[model samples]
Target: MVDIEKKIIEIIKHKPVILKKIYELLQAENKEDRRLIRKTAKKMLSDGIAYKDSKNKYHLVSSKQVVGTIEFTKSGNMAFLSDKNGDEIAITVENSLNAMHKDRVLIEKIGQWRDLPSGRVIRILNNEIERIVGQFQKKKMFGFVIPLNGKINYDFYISPENMNNAKEGEIVEVEILKHKSKNKNPEGKIIKILGKPGDPSIDLPIIITKHGLPNPGEFPKKVMEEALKIPEKISKKEFKGRKDFRDQLIFTIDGDTAKDFDDAVGLKKLNNGNYELGVHIADVSHYVNDNSDLNKEAYKRSTSIYLINTVIPMLPHELSDWICSLVQDEDRLTMSLIMEINKDGDVVKSNIYNGIINSKKRLTYSKANKILENNADENLMEEIGFLKETLESMKELMYIIRENRKRRGSILDIESGEVYFEFDENGYVKDILKRERGISEKIIEEFMIKANETVAEFFDIKGLPFIYRVHENPDGEMLIQLKNYLEILGIKFKIPETMHPKVLQEILEKTKDHPLNESIQKLLVRSMKRAIYSNNNIGHFGLASNSYTHFTSPIRRYPDLIVHKMLKKYIEGKNDLKKQDIEKYSKILPDISESCSKKERVADEAEWDLIDMKKIEYIRKHIGEKYEVFVTGVTKFGLFVEIPEKMINGLIHISELDDYFIYNERDNSLVGDKTKKTYRVGDKIKAVVAKADKLTLQVDFIPYENYIKINKKNTKNYFNKKNKNGNKKTFKKKGKNK
Candidate 1:
């Protein structure tokens, strides 16, 4: 077998283009012979001496040639290779189709169409995880496993003897026993059964597997023991060289369900008439020392995963929830940003320090909102009077600062939505709510922004190596598409070549009262580039600021924690690190940022998926009932409508539209070719629930005739004119009598 593998490697090295035919020939054999050949081929491929073509053809790529990680879709047939240059190349599932997601593979470019290079996976650089979470099933004498994640499209063939204790409909983890060939599914054996389908506990296993994230249960006891050793109470020695702000009336504002409080704010009127606002963030780095068990665990997880009903913290409960948490009345260590701002919200003086703080109050946004509206309880009124006054003063300062940001061309006011969950004691969602933006959220946001900007500016002045939160300008193509979409809606908004944040803000301001404000805002956000962490201080496009960095909430966000460390290092005049060290840090910072961002997105998707499942469950009883909906998306296959009252979305299939016959991509509408009836994105309509699939979390809808009638009557003249001038006029006469 070893000699055969060596022969295969030599053959590929000599004639790489013949890999496809060779593999095919080897596969078209008896079972025992094929197994032997496959083992040899697998070993040879793993050596990285050859490459595969997009067509599944094999060829030899040089040992020093380009290679990258390959991620497979569930189908096990196709894969995408992410190269060192950040370019992803698509590969057919056939030739080297056995490679899984995140498997490093060597590739040799085979051809090109125009400027697009095409390649194939020649050698498997590494194998992905052998274990996967799926559901077990039996069909007569045979058994199979269906993967929980859509990305893992291939079903595993499970032998009866290796079924373990898994029963039909039981969610279980499976270990791959054998690789797939041209005519067979990969063989697997059930290892552990999780729970029955639709069980809430099943969700965590599914989510963990789906995103390829490690299970929290895997945390070592050593790490847990180390985490427990960290002191919960503040000590004099720990507070050495730290400023004391325990006497200040600082407070934390978070959600009702929030356990870990990481940030606190305090405001005071300075003698010079300027406001001295302090943003204090929990200093997790102080206790979770570098290279320690707790630090290692936190670094591995990167960020906490906030699901609908649970928060999977990066640090264990000892640190994330109890010890380092900035709970009210508890003396906690914090990295503080003390800034002096004039009446116009212009920064006059700023300083960063390691400090001890005592939070005076812990407030929820809802309660704060009520109090700010002057509808406060007796005790609340007395306890929160100073904080309320400070909040009002902060609001005034924020408005001025916001205006200044706008004048400077910052891109603010993107329409963003937050999903709120009402959970049962069992950890299941009772209800899902779309949290609306309010003054309370804005107050916190404004302070965080001011703190971040101040820190960035301070680091810039010091000429230090620091991580900055930067957002580059949007891609030219995306901007053009945005402009085109706006033009289609008869909205004249020009996106400059070098666009500023103020331009976006202006557009939002102009369309604030418009019916399509939400739609336009969504488009604007989609067109912008994502913000990332980097050592270089490029300006943030979304904030419309020249320089920005994450300096707030160091306890939860790793980048902010890194920023604090760098700031402290610079403040102490430790200029020992070299240019090479800075460059090395800069290169890895982007990767870390990208990884953390991906994890955040995965968490978001999992949360959405769970909520969608709960939503389907909630609406199950309402099938066939009608609700008012707004068209949120339009595609060739269907129109997506969201129930405005509940924010639940369903698809109105193209076939379900009896009146509208033509799909128009230009205006994003479905039109009746004969009657010229139109249903466009952002247009309000009534839709009846047609079907709901619990397994897929898909909701189907059909138009409500009564609502359509009302819509038609409201825009009678517009529809009449459109009908008279449309191409539908030619088909009108032929279809009317039929």
Candidate 2:
């Protein structure tokens, strides 16, 4: 029988015949011999060493074929071939048994149908993931872990001995031991136990896992010790050959809670009736040299992560907050952009140099705004008398510059807002507010903008290699959609064939005082592409500049530090930057920019997640209570409503809309089929807190028609009456009284 099985296997291996033919060829007079051949063939087929083609022919898979990575979706697996232009092939779970998400696998194109590709995973080239987050479960004798991240759908069956003291209901980091195989679930071992489920601290790990970011581990002892050794004082030798601006009345302006002051500004009326505007940034690169421990740590962080009440700084507090920070009344080394601007705000002359600066005072935006509004304190009023005069002159120059910018088709009127959190002594949020644009913020912004533009232009004229912040124009399809949406609201928006910043700015200005201003501004921002760092100058669309780069805030931004280094090299006449090096930097800049951007997004997500959790807790106490909400976002799934009083937003799912209509994606609305009732984006409505789920951090809202409709009608009447007065003037709409 063994001899017969061996003979049959050999024949099958060498035969290029159909299964029917092979079966016929392997025919034996005795039933025992035939059964043996059949069993062997079945085993070989199951092993994937052989496959049946469309014609039912059995053959060995060719070794030299296509290879690529497999990306797993919620439904199944799709193999992305190595050819840059090749269409990805779909792989069924039966054939993708061993492959995991982002794992490199050898794919053999079995066939193609109507331009769609089909393939099987012949071999898994590489396994991309080593650790994953999951919930641990226990059986009678063994355990199983289910991944929280849906991308890793498979459960890992763990032996009881390998449970590593992790209890049921505990979230943990699991190390993959073996991928999915024929007779077992993917095996894994518990590496580290995260906290109990539903803990607020678990949000950090979840976000980190979702974004594939590194966990915050203890700093290396050597790195920490070296960072501790950084001196607190600026050395005299460090100031050699550098420009000195210590006598300049430079002052730092930031949020009241801000710790690290990276930038300062000084404005004065020059002898020639021009304005001397000095923008100085901390000289971080001077202390953090290349290949040093501090530099390595900064590069690893890439950017700071600011959560609700915590900031994970890129550099340690010793350096970021004290040593490098431009603290008030403290002398610090800095890289300065000194611009001599005429009354028209045109840059007449500019100089970039390393310098020493003393921040004469630390000003908060509130104080500055108060002073600008003529409500300054006695001491502040005295101290800022000359400064206010200088600022008034600078303001005039800025307006001229701004007018010139607008005339040059610049997009300078984009709406932006920051979330304000009022925290108690314990760093818990007492209140949350939306911080909008103010004159003080605008003044600082204008100065910083002028400084950045001047430095960028200088670099361009010098033909130096520096990282520029570039934003490309929006895609045609997005702009068309935006135009159509605006038209639906009776708003006239003309998007050019080649969408430019000026067109966007014009639309924003037109809608600045509209009821849907926030919604429209958000949509406009969404329509534009994200700005990124690059060596080549593509120009900035948001800033409406032909060339722009980060030349301010070197204390926090790595690109600004790099820009400073380049400026220094240029000033020293050492223009030895090779084209290839610049090209390399160009290529590398995008990846770094993407990484930093991802971190920023993660930080935002973490902060929002915590806030959402807190909001859920806050609303739980107010269940059955009503509040005025503005419809901020609309989707087929649900509407997002922002509670203006608390500055918290929650979703009103489609199922909870009380039989209102199907969603209209085109108009961003929901309309009833029978009544023709419509709920549109940016419409203010009163809603009662129906449900607050702490586990999900979800708040469900149900519309309070009786409370909202009355106020809405009154608002409409007031607007109509105001319009009847022949005044096409801007007016603020008040929400309904709760």
lDDT of 2 by residue, 210-240 (tens): 4455555345676778778988898889889
Please give the distance, in angstroms, between residue 558's alpha carbon in candidate 1 and its true position after superposition.
1.9
Task: Tell me how candidate 1 scores on lDDT.
Answer: 0.71
**The candidate that achieves the highest TM-score relative to the unseen native structure:** 1
C-alpha-based local distance difference test score of model 2: 0.70
The Cα local distance difference test for each model comes to 0.71, 0.70
For lDDT, the strongest prediction is: 1
Candidate 2, which ten residues in sequence have the lowest lDDT sum? 722-731
TM-score of each: 0.81, 0.74
Q: What is the lDDT of residue 66 in candidate 1?
A: 53
Sequence-dependent TM-score of model 2:
0.74
Once superposed on the true structure, which residue ranges of model 1 sit more than 4 Å away at CA? Answer: 1-66, 71-80, 91-96, 110-118, 214-218, 423-430, 461-463, 475-478, 574-590, 659-679, 705-738
